[model samples]
Target: MSSDEEWSSGEDDSQPSKLVRKAREAPFVPIGLAGCLTLVAYGLYKIKDRGNQKLSVHLIHMRVAAQGFVVGAITIGVLYSMYTDYVNPTSSKPKK
Candidate 1:
């Protein structure tokens, strides 16, 4: 089988994962990923100095940071879409 067929589940335009499609269309996905990685790295660095602290606590914070970044990116994308669609439409329409 070809690489495309292998990556996709079925013989359709829709890919196996929705995240892949969104990452292609949305610009914020890369930024969100970078932010998440930075937060996780920071968490790791902070945890390394404190051997007495529970690892689970630091892990939870990392998870929260990642989720928060994803949520924020989605929110910004939605708002920007709304603005382009309603507030400042770029498409030209004939007046009725």
Candidate 2:
């Protein structure tokens, strides 16, 4: 009998076992990159609105808005990273 036929004919439990094994092995690089990108974008947006400021009050308002945007972006990034890493680690990495 052919090797493929022999392997497929067996009523083994290795399929589920292999899936379980793979579920335990994954990387977190993408999660980290996503977080860093979010922070960088926030920083850029926060700093890019400081042009042609005619009054101190306007400048202060801009600064406060910028800070809020940055903080919100960072918080979202961190929460997403943690969720992806802990709640669904298997989908975080691709199979090689």
Candidate 3:
């Protein structure tokens, strides 16, 4: 037997190649925050006012608070998506 044949750790070359995978989705924060936000909005909606004059004011206040929370959560989701999927510089520096 040849020394060349004896030295080889052989592997077959007949398999088809596969493409690299697309990036994975971010796990849970966006959805969890969304749920909590919904619950808060519902709670706000269910608050009762004794007078009709104050009910409109209460609903409006609740609506504004819910809308603000939604906007803030959406902003956070956008920034997180951008950081995970688009902002790969291969390294990060820790804050002091």
Candidate 4:
């Protein structure tokens, strides 16, 4: 008779978690998030070094920079999706 440990070991434990699978499937999302975070951090650093500019102006520019980066990332993700779907789909249906 197989021991409990042996039976359990036979089970497939190598499958990745849902989060890991999703991350692998849509890697751009995490990349975009990281880029947004980096931009925000840089903005904060610049704000600390603000010499003569008003706080409001610095804040506005920072906001624009962060938002612009996120927008660009989203656009790239969309374009990539479109290309994969239309130009080179991974799974195509068989013809009748």
- Taking all chains together, each candidate's TM-score versus the true structure is 0.61, 0.42, 0.43, 0.67
How many residue pairs clash in all the candidates, one count each? 0, 0, 0, 0
Please report how far candidate 1 places residue 50 from its true position, in Å.
4.0
lDDT of candidate 3 at residue 60, scale 0 to 100: 73
RMSD, model 2, all Cα superposed?
A: 14.3
lDDT of 2 by residue, 2-95 (tens): 6655344345548886555444442233344445566556645656575775457565665565555556665776677788789988877798
lDDT of 2: 0.58
44-96, model 4: which lDDT tens digit per residue?
88887899999999888888887888788878988888887898786433557
In candidate 3, list every pair of residues with a backbone clash: none
Runs in model 1 deviating more than 4 A are 1-24, 91-96
Model 1 residue pairs with clashes: none
Q: Using TM-score, give the best candidate's number.
A: 4
lDDT of 1 by residue, 1-96 (tens): 766544544654455456677676787877788888888888888887757778898799788988899789878988887887898786524557
Candidate 1 displacement at residue 94 in angstroms: 16
In angstroms, the error of model 2 at 76 is: 1.2
Q: What is the lDDT of residue 61 in candidate 3?
A: 68
**Candidate 3 — worst ten consecutive residues by lDDT sum?**
15-24
After superposition, candidate 2 runs with Cα above 4 Å error: 1-54
> Against the unseen true structure, what C-alpha lDDT does each candidate score?
0.77, 0.58, 0.56, 0.77
